[model samples]
Structure formats: C-alpha cells, structure tokens
Target: MRGEEMNFEPMMKMMSLSSIGLMIWIAAQTFTPPKEVVVYVEVPAPVVVTQVIHAPISTARPAPRPDSLCLALNIYHEARGEPLKGQVAVGQVTLNRAAVAYKGASSVCDTVFARKQFSWTHEDPRQPSGAELRPSLDLARKILAGRYIDRTHGALHYYNPHKVDAWWADSYAEVAVLGNHRFMR
Candidate 1:
C-alpha cells in the first residue's frame, strides 16, 4: 500500500510540471513586440493674395474760396496786365454779390429760375421773395463761391459785357440771366 501511494504522488508532480511549461510557452508567443514601419509623404507650399490702395488726403490748408477763383484771378491779371490785387478783388466781388443777393423785394428772387424777373443785372424783377429766395440765393452764393458754373460752360454772370454782346439777343432766352444792360445790348 505505501509503495502505491508514493507512485501516485510522482504522477501528480509530473502532471503539474507539464501544465506550468505549457502556460509559459503560450505567454511568450502571445506577448510578441510590435513591428517598426517607415513611410514618406509630400506637402504643398502656402498661397498669397494682392489688393488696391488710394492716395492719402493732403495736409496743406486750402484757401477760403475755390481754387478756380485763384486760377481765374491769375489768368485775368496776366491777360489785362492788371495787378494781382485787382484779380483778387474780382474774386471777392463774386463772393460778396453772392452773399447779399436778396437785398430788395424784387432782388429777393434774383437768384431763382423765374424768367420774367431774369435781368442782365443783379436786380432781377422776377426774383423770389422771403423764404423762397433764401435757399436758392444761398445755393447760388455757394456755387459762385465754389467757382462752379451751374451750366457746363457760360459767361460768369454779366460781369463781362463782351460775352453778352457776342451772343445774339434771341440767345439770351437760353441764358439763366442776361449780362448787365451794358453788355446785353
């Protein structure tokens, strides 16, 4: 009986040793290190855009009246052989007349578009009165001061009699105002 029991113990020991060896082999195969790989890729360069710019405003101060006034004064003075002061005075008068355009009731509408009142002189009979004349006169004054001729091209008021005379009397109808009587006939 003792011998049989000892034989059984050795058999059990062999079985346990075989199971441990099988487990170690399985663990080693399952835990293999990951393989290393090398790859190449191409990338493109960045793109650029362009844009227009305007000139900066001038810092130099401007004269009170329009620059045209200065130019006209220069030309008039040079042509007639007059002093610069006379040219400047001419510009000033244009500004001044524009300022007090509605002094009289008849002159009130002096700057308006009424044809009947339209005269060769500053005093137009058909000129607007009171509030009606104010806005138009004010605008006219501004235009004159700015040296902007309302029409594309025309005589500067009735100041130059020569221009008025050169145009036919019937042509006066087309003009906003005829030149002063001296020029109109």
Candidate 2:
C-alpha cells in the first residue's frame, strides 16, 4: 500500500505540472499581438515622347521687276561704297521719297528717275556688273520684300557731308548722320 501511494502522488504532480504548462501556453497565445499583413501594388511609369516638324524649302527666288531693278541700281550707285547700314538707309530714303509722291512721281522707279533727284540719273547710268553689285542687289531685294527696317528715322533725303551744301539741306530737318552721308527729313 505504501508503494502504491508513492506512485500515485508522483503521477498526480506530473499531471498538475503538464496542466499548468498547457494553461501558460494558451494565455501567451491569447495575449500576444497579431502579425500585420503588408500588401504591395505596382504602378506604371510615365512615358515621354518628342516630335519635330520640318518645313518645305524654297529653291528659287521670285523674278525681279523694273522698279526693283531701278531701286537696286540706285542703291548700288549711291551707297555701295558705304557700310550695309548706310545702304539700307539709302534704300529706306528712296522708299520714303516714293511714299511722299514728290514731283508727280508715284512709284519707286518714278521717284528714283525723277528729274534732278539723284545725281547718277542726270547722266545715262551704266549698269553695274552682277559680281560688283551683289551686295546692293541683295539689300535691294530685302528692302523690296519689306523685310528691312528703316534705320534713317523717316529720312527722305541724304547727302555726302564732304560735298558742297545744297539749298534743299536748309529747307528739310536733319535726321541722322550715317557713314559719309547726312540724312534729312
């Protein structure tokens, strides 16, 4: 009977210890924080595109008229020796004179060829070679095309400063002095 009692006591202690351990494990599972779930979403990257448009190129220049030719000749004879700015000023003056309708002259050609207007026109003016007059010709084309700005500030007359003073210089107001010439309005 003593052996039986001792064996029963040890069995009861083992069962109690196992039951305590089981209760602790269950408490830990109930009290512990839950693990967080992470979700990932993929986004598409933005695409960039570039485009260039080309314009059609013109191969030939338009045919020049008699008035344009006359204006070119006048610029060639008048301001060819001067700087490009001076040539442009001369062209502007011619255009300005044409605008004024001076001495029954209505067009650019008429204004340029008007009696005693340009010194070169007093005589039969010789046509300059294309190679010699290329700069004046180009400038004239730009002026006729209305692509040039007036540098003379609305000047209608210009004269070489080295030359003798003319009676007309006193009548019109002096506007500008460009290169070797003085512009008057």
Candidate 3:
C-alpha cells in the first residue's frame, strides 16, 4: 500500500475526471453528425417601381383608389404646361390639403374640388389623355404610396407667378418655386 500514490485529493480528482471523461466519450460516440440536412427559407418578391410607373392609367377609375384619379387630375390640370417638378409640386399641395382634411375635405377628390380652391375645379371638367396623365398618374401613385419626396416641403398652397398675385399670398410662409407655381405652407 505504501508503494502506491496515496494522495487522496489527487486520486479523487482523477476519479471524477475519469467519470466525466467516460460520460463525454460515450456521448461523443452516440452523436452521429446529422445526415445531410436540407433547410428551406422563404424570400419575398422584389418590388419593381418602374413597372408601376410605366403601367397604363385608366380613367375608368377603380372605386377604392379614387385618390389616384383625383391626384392625377390635379397635377395634369394645374401644371401640364410646366415642368415635371412643377407637376409633382402641385400634387404635393393637394396631398397636404387632404392629409389635414383642409376645408373639410376628407379625401383627395374632396380636396381637389374644394370650392374655389383650384381654378379648374370651378370650370368644366376636362378629359385628359392617358399620355397626358402618365406622368401625373405615376407621381400620384408615388405620393399616395408614401414614396415621393415632398418637393414643396409640406406646402398646402401654390399660385402661378405670371398669374394673379393672390391677396392672401402674404398670409403664409413661401416654401418653394418649382417652375411657374410658387409653393407656400
């Protein structure tokens, strides 16, 4: 007995390590690296913005999306002769009015045709061609989709520089001048 190593703590520690090591070895032997497993992950479809812009716009407007028709009409009628940015600016103003229910208008159509707010609203309804409405329609969809940058910086009003200097123009802060129209907050 004296010839053998008699350190009790070291012997106990060795025994514990052997037991744990034996259990680990058994577990390691039982584990078969899982068979070639197959995993599937779902991916969403990509949105093509250009496809939406180039799509045909119909005057036979859908009921649920009348906002598009109303917004397009505003842009086409208000800034058809002006540049593209001017047209978008006009649409932005109409959107701003609709957002706050201005003049008790709860929708884009209501805002566009609000009393004498826009000159064309008081006049005869004009039928614009799809080609004429293409740009406006594209811009309108973009605006409603929350994708368009507010070129007017939240302007709710605008008037042509060459046209009448409205008596109330001095009442609000002017925001931007896109083309012919001066935008105001």
Better of 1 and 2 by TM-score: 2
TM-score of 3: 0.62
The TM-score ranking, best first, is 2, 3, 1
For residues 77-159, could you state the per-residue lDDT of candidate 1 as single tens digits? 22223243323333333443334553332222233222422332334334333354333333334444565433312323323
TM-scores of all predicted structures: 0.20, 0.63, 0.62
Lowest-scoring 10 consecutive residues by lDDT in candidate 1?
36-45
Residue-level error in angstroms, candidate 2, position 159: 0.2
- Name the weakest run of 10 consecutive residues (lDDT summed) in model 2: 36-45
lDDT of 2 by residue, 80-124 (tens): 888878888898899998988878887999999999999999887
Model 2 Cα RMSD, 1 decimal:
34.3
Q: How far off is residue 38 in model 2, in Å?
A: 84
Candidate 2 colliding pairs, count? 0
Clash pairs (backbone) in predicted model 1: 109-127, 109-128, 110-127, 117-126
lDDT, candidate 3, 1-185, per-residue tens: 21222223333333444563464345335433333211111222342321111112223335537899889888888888988788878888998999999999989999998999999988897788878777888888887888868889999999996978688999989989899999898
The local distance difference test score of model 2 is 0.71
